[model samples]
Target chain A: MKILSTLILLVALALGSAQAQKFITKSGNIRFFSSTPIEDILAHNRQVNSALDQQTGDFVFRVLMKSFQFEKALMQEHFNENYVESDKFPNATFTGKVTNIKDIDFAKNGVYNAIVEGDLTIKGVTKKISEKGTFEVKDGKVIGKSTFNVLVEDYGIKIPGAVAKNIAKSIQIDVDVNLEKLE
Target chain B: MKKKWLIIIGGLAAAGIVLALLVYFFVYNKPHKDYSKAKPDFEVEAIAFFEEFRTNAAASSARYNGKVIAITGQLSSVEVTDEQVVALFEIDEGMFGSEGVRCVLIPEKAETLISIPPGSTITIKGHCTGYNETDVILEHCSIAI
Candidate 1:
């Protein structure tokens, strides 16, 4: 009986520690910009959900397509109806891992370069992406930030010839999230 | 007769230019909807709204996504930052974490949202973006009460 109790206690402690290593944020921010000689377009989405498991170096993000806000109503409508087709594909998700998780100490308060490789799905098309970003740990909170470029054609987005000059072929995406301990 | 035709052609060209300019400004530079002042398309309780998404995400998203909605529920938590203010109405315990309706309030409602404590029932009106499998996100929310 004593041995069984000891085994139970060990399992409980293991689960507790595992939970401590998880960090999450439901209000993460993602901004994308398209620049062209004729016109520049920008959109911001703040209702991003992200989770990072420090133990396994896994990071995931779920972004609602309709949440992206543009400066002009016409651009927002076109982006949803024509570009991304938000009605058909409502979410964009990324599931990736920090490949160099061993180099950074989560307990330390500093910034560390992180290499993340994962699958990004947008408008029902999935692509493998490898990008570099920084993770800053301060006062037990983790801030993950990265900027990367995404090709419009790679995601199956086709710009019409009439307004091609107004939109860039490549869009720059910026991700900023402050993650808190799950417990 | 030739001079009259030239003047008529010039007048038509000037009118065409003015019409094109008006169309460009009105169609291309239209402003975004003001969610704060917009009427809610659907008003529902928080739990029921969340359950619909949890049960049939695709169907619910098709019906509610990109629409203005009003939801009433007990506030589970409030997160405030310099950039944004968010109020959560937790509906269930999911694999990632607590999942429910997450309303990102407009800047004008920051003070009102902060004053309300957790467990108090309140109504929020905003633009329903869609369910992210974890939470039904609403942007540009304002306190309906």
Candidate 2:
């Protein structure tokens, strides 16, 4: 009987804490880098928006592909037309949750590393990924950051061998995000 | 000996001239459009604008061509290309509501983007060139500092 009462109290507290975390950020960053011996390409998209459900550890991030710019006009054309098919797949996304919710204390200040497992979708392909990311809580604001790699082929991005050797099979991705506490 | 020295100097000068010309062609002669100068037609919050644009990219692509529009948001991505400069400005944490749309600015307008750090607010002006899903295309855009 005592254990049941304690469980009820814990569930109530969790629900209350989640209700308190209604904040989100309108802008975030997602970057991709593909380096090959023949050419090294780096592209990033800054205009990302995401929301974090503190109670459920649910998050969603998005960006447009056409927004990615390259230095050479030829390269930009190729990126949109050939590589990313910007016209076909205009947006990329990440939807997931933080596994260890009990470890995060949003009211406190300091940096804590959390493992966030989520599904990242790009170019019409989705993959399950677990990322080790940094989370910071300061003055009611939370910031999250992580870096990982994804294979182009996994998403069905095909590169001809002529330049394929130059482009690594897997691309490195970096993410930096910040969110404000909502009332 | 004096004649030979003069000839050598002449050759060196000619080589220097050729090198300078080559550098100019390779470095500075190409297209240098910086679209960050096109005036903005409107100013809208990033999230709300993205939602509206994404809802109608397929229908509006033709109408948006070469149209200038203004957007404010965090700088999400920057890509420098020889044919054109492109930047992706985004805002949204969810796929719904006001968080899915982005402004893709190209060409000369990119020049005004002096520096964009992650998590900073920026307002940009450029022409709309239709839509690819959630991206609102802008041509000849410039930043409104």
Candidate 3:
């Protein structure tokens, strides 16, 4: 009877872990592009932290603003100090749920169209957004990619009038995350 | 006499423009830190560093974020991504199983990666990216031999 009790306890613990199906990626990629008559600006941040819950269809992504690197050191410095104000607002985060979670099979090896609705916080302002994304499940990994455009004025990021010609009113952002099942 | 004054003013304006261009190209546009030779601002054991961040994330970030730090600890794991190499130092495993400090190395200059094995003590220098979940991250790391 004692041995039977121990077996039951072990199985219960195993089932508890299996129920928490979470996939996470630490080194995700985020890039932003802006085009103007004068110059085109581009920046990338590789140390993006993100996660997806398989059971709940919940998603979250967080990135440090200062981690973004640009080709020109001056541009990077201006982006942090003047534009994003990294000292006051250090990180940008997104938290939302996938609406079509039930339509896609987690165990299948194929690409599925997904819609994510969430709140994106940048420069201390939070805005609700929904965007189309691609979810690919293959070889024990989940890959996600999406592209969207955001207006700088909505987030209260102002481009000074003196150099306004060097920047665009809207910026295009690209996100790619390759997640592995949490073990 | 008027022509002489005009020539002097033109010459001074030209010199000012040249000076401004030189400063823009040489001073403001240069790289900020020479990480290959810059000394670490703070040196501490890996376990203590991780503990501080885990205990209080906000205070720890204010003290260490964006700063170059040196940490000594046992190598836990080495991961090579497509763009860079990341080394995790084992501070302590949680009741469940979570790691501690994670340092990402410069792919080009990570020459000392071959010598250190898992569980061997080593020192590394890098820019701290603050704490996230079970990790205290650093980027552009260089191992100290």
List the DockQ of the predictions in order. 0.85, 0.09, 0.43
Give me the runs in candidate 1 sitting further than 4 Å from their true place. Answer: none
lDDT (C-alpha) at residue A126 in model 3: 99
Q: How many clashes does each candidate structure show, in the order listed?
A: 0, 48, 0
Candidate 2 ranges with C-alpha deviation above 4 Å: A1-20, B1-33, B37-58, B61-124, B127-145
Listed in order, each prediction's TM-score against the native is 0.97, 0.62, 0.90
Alpha-carbon error at A49 in model 2, in Å? 1.3
**C-alpha positional error of residue A76 in candidate 2 after TM-score superposition, expressed in Å:** 2.3
lDDT of 2 by residue, B1-145 (tens): 9999999999999999999999866763355244565455566776666666666665444344334667777776665533345556655543333333344444444565636665678877765544533345554566775
Query: Which candidate tops TM-score?
Result: 1
What is the iRMSD in Å for candidate 2?
A: 5.0
Docking class of 2: incorrect
Local accuracy of candidate 3 as per-residue lDDT tens digits, A1-94? 9999999999999787664578888889999999998999999988888888887789999888877878788888889889998767777899
DockQ measured for candidate 1: 0.85
Per-model chain B TM-scores are 0.95, 0.53, 0.88
Candidate 3 regions exceeding 4 Å error are A1-20, B92-97
In the range A70-130, model 1's lDDT, one tens digit per residue, is 9999999999999999999999999999999888788999999999999999999999999
lDDT-better candidate, 2 vs 3: 3
Better of 1 and 2 by DockQ: 1
